[model samples]
Target: MKLANKRPFVTTLFLRPILLLLTLIGNYTGICKKLNVAAAELVEAKAVCATRLRLRLRQAQATATCIVTLIVLIFAGAGTAVSVQAITPNQAIDGLQQLAAQAEENGSIRVLVQLDLPFRAEGELETDAAVQAQQANIDGLQNMVLEQMADTNTAVIATFKYIPYLALELDAAALETLAALPAVVAIEEDIPVPPALSSSIPVIGADAAWSVGYTGAGQTVAILDTGVDTNHAAFTTGGNRIVAQGCYSTTNASYSATTVCPGGVEEATGAGTGVDCTAVVGPTNSKAQSDCGHGTHVASIAAGDDGGSIVGVAPDANIIAIQIFSLFNSTTYCGGFSNCVLTFTSDQILGLEHVYELRNSYNIASVNMSLGGGQYFATCDSDSRKAAIDNLRAVGIATVIASGNDGYRDSIGAPSCISSAISVGATDDVDNVASFSNIAPFIDLVAPGVSIFAAVPGGAGTKQGTSMATPHVAGAWALFKQAVPTASVDEALAAFQAGAVLVDDNRSGGVETDLARLNINNAINSYVTGLSVAVTASEDYLLPDDLVEFTVQITNNTGSVASQVVLTAPIPQPLSLDAALLSGDAAVVDGQIVWTTGQTLNPGQSLTRTVSFVVKN
Candidate 1:
């Protein structure tokens, strides 16, 4: 074929050395035996006498470039060309056909067909009319595929709009025919991703914030996971703390539609009285409630209040359970056993969309997605899930995600890898990085995740993963928002990062050897301008009528010194402090031990004092 444009000198300069090397490599060994025919053909075709080659080069220099242009096109289309190279189907489609042949006795195999499409910003398509038009285009494309498949008596099982894709069930003959279609970019079998499978609140200093009365009260953190058990005491006071609930997983089959919860109301005011959406049902005989207790644990970790035994980081914060995963029958072997699939990307996208939709009514402060999969070394801005997160964040909601449990450098997964999401890694009680936490530059903070105690479906339990680490950060964000009502998402994230205490661990196999562990007290203290106090008892377990020693440390962390610093400790019943030992304007007022320092503490300065008390019978 004649070349369209000619740059003979430039083309020759680049291709001459490549052609020469290939010719030498081809002659020494039968390169054709090792190389694909396309590469071998080019090397063999360009083989000619030195004089003839020079003559052709000189001729091309005067007229046009053909050989180099053809070579460039061939390599460029090697793996990605769906239409141009479909005369010989691409590797992806070829693999599908092979799979079909292997499973011929089982009939057709299901595959996802990813199509190539131009990028269109969601904002540009924000108007109702615009959205409808874009959806119409997607539907039209899907209909075209369905019609084409009809010729072979095949059909599309599902269509994905967020991205131009379709799931289809086809035989070998039908798969080959579909592969030849110009619209098809790739065809691959649906791969099942298993669930990646938490914390003490005090190690993170959340207890300090609680002492100061910033308990995430009135804020709501939406959790997108398996499904929460609203009946759990952690999620209920007199009424359920779960303000809203929805199921986006397709495992139940009936709940496949993302419109609303199947068999459950969209919203409810109390526990067990709310939505009863269908539980996830996989072929492996799994249920969200019975088989997967992840969501309840995650929810409790973020906002549960079980009379203090298993208090969440944000004990009083409301919860919105957006169930995105349910147990499904596993089509492939899972860890040598047949376990149900845990989640899907489409379900996650739908859950995110629902969160965005409910943002206004619930005033969602943060979104806790303690679930992730798929390794993405860099930020995944192009994924639809990332887009959904960005959309929510644009409106002032913070998205907190778990760095994957892959334990590899640069292995943070999507949604979490998105720049807008606060990606969290796991740390143990001693502030050591968890061995399984994925480390990368994207990780925003670390939290107590190893053997974390939280509420599960049937009361409470302990679990571990970066999944556990994520909710701690999410709850911290809610606390920050409650403390600083005007803080934006960026401001909240920065405060949290600034408050993180750096931890050392060998588990970080990546360039980042140390991670910043979340410190909620520091995070809240960073935004407040005043003296902050942290109190501790010499003994945690004190018997009634026993002498108790308490130490209080007050620090002025603001830009200026805190004058007239007054430290007040509320004395509850069964506790009495010795008045004679009190010093420096110390007095007992309204059943509280008040120390009026009347002293100026300079910035970054701290003062410590010990007070003796006796437990009353």
Candidate 2:
């Protein structure tokens, strides 16, 4: 087997060493007998639990420092499980003990059930026919499980079509019934995920790619967050950049929050449904207004373009927007804040499923999810979102996530902590890891995230966090996908890691892990990018002698430099464009604007030239 191009950054993951220590605490009859250090090892393992306490402090302090809300669902039920009901062994999955306690206290708990059988993603079932058959088998098993648990006091939230998992709001009896079934594997709480954006664009060398070309044209990136501001110029370049949109939010009385999707129901899909975070009204907070723009800011950082004024990582890449957040207006669940922008784990999975479904249709290089919660010291391969993320990976879509802003020294958040995800931490312009960025050993990459200026609800704003850092890498993933369509997730990540500039944690007493910071120009070997220029008229069909407006858009695709560039084209009538949009005043000769100065357009840089002309008036 060829083993050369594997990602060294993660190939030597700290998971193995941590798991080795964990195994001793669980079952080590022979090892303990042989080594005779079981007591000391157990003490060490218990000390590791201190890290968990630090995580709580980090989350609790967010009310003052940041807006990353960690939601802990309130326990409410009729009584304890009827007669100490049996719980299937789910020791491998974390948080079950807490769920059991909650169930014991309330007699009801909502948990995610994972079946042993996969929804056709586990093995080598490549062909369409094989995949379909596997899916049918999965459906049959899930139906059987549902039928068995039908008598218990349970409500089904949702089920996965490609991943073998189900979100169920059930009582203790139902939990017992579902866990006992032979097909059932593990059960975990569907914890809430907090909204987590942008940056110094040229610091990462995105402009170099624009100089040549390769600005993520002819591809799409899925944004699974609160929602995108599609009306913003960052998204509306020539036409609507959001090629597709979907909504997956749930209104649960458990959190005193309602669904963010339109119709006030659980799920919906269509145009304008993926609007900016302004969907929620009647709420006010110092953080609420800016937090509402989280989705838009994150999206803009990844692939936003605004008539040459501001550009994202992949300026021309289309977007598949999925609003996965729910509006929590009650201060009870808003961490004492007036409102909270959050999403459930199941909602994130739904967004991933939507992206996977569109993999064949669109050149979806990556899915950017700048939301996460919970904390894990080790790789969370058994996380509820892992299946959906792995499903997307099988079809060649990278799941890029923010490493969280908790400022923990040795831990990242839940979904990003999952092994398959390309977790990104935040770095400043000087390549120093941001003080607040999580620095877990499992983190995949870091990018510029300090005071990143990107599109917000009504205008542009600057925000700093790992959430901002993730999109820079996500946009870079789109560029890599455009450059090498067939590259696997690992391959693309490896390419970036291979070319990345190394940064160390100089923060006193920080995690000793050395991290790779994003430097696309260095990583792609050469700085060649693709460029795209577009021209559009405000109204295609205007009556004679009517005033018309023409739009000329020139986007730096990818590459280093395009010499002797001419940015002029034939129009119905002679018209002049806004000089601010273009890079230079070219040699205007023969009714054409020829750019004579050797200009350098950054990768994903866009220049929009607008001209309003009176055709015959």
lDDT of all predictions: 0.66, 0.71
Kindly list the per-residue Cα lDDT of model 1 for residues 1-617, writing each as its tens digit: 23434456457766775676565455534533454546434343233222233433433442324454455564565476633332244453547556677437546665667654443534444554545444455555666667767878465555655446676667777877887665566666643344456238879888878886778998999987766777777877646788887775443232122222454332222333223323443343432234337777888888889785779999989998876654443334244333454555656665677777787787688988886677887886645455567667766788898888988666687668888788888888987778888878767888888998888765788889988888998898888888776677877777776566666556535467446788887776655344467778878777776676767778886665545545544566566656655544567775667676566778899888777666655
Model 1, CA-based lDDT: 0.66
State the weakest 10-residue window (summed lDDT) of model 2: 67-76
Per-prediction tally of clashes: 11, 33
Candidate 2 whole-model C-alpha lDDT, 0 to 1: 0.71
Model 2: per-residue lDDT, tens digit, 103-185? 76766776888876634453346565556555655565567678878888888888788877888887666666666565577
Model 2 earns a TM-score of 0.70
Q: CA lDDT of 515 in candidate 1?
A: 69
Off by over 4 Å in 2: 1-97, 104-107, 118-124, 197-199, 276-282, 286-292, 526-617
RMSD over all Cα atoms, model 2? 21.4
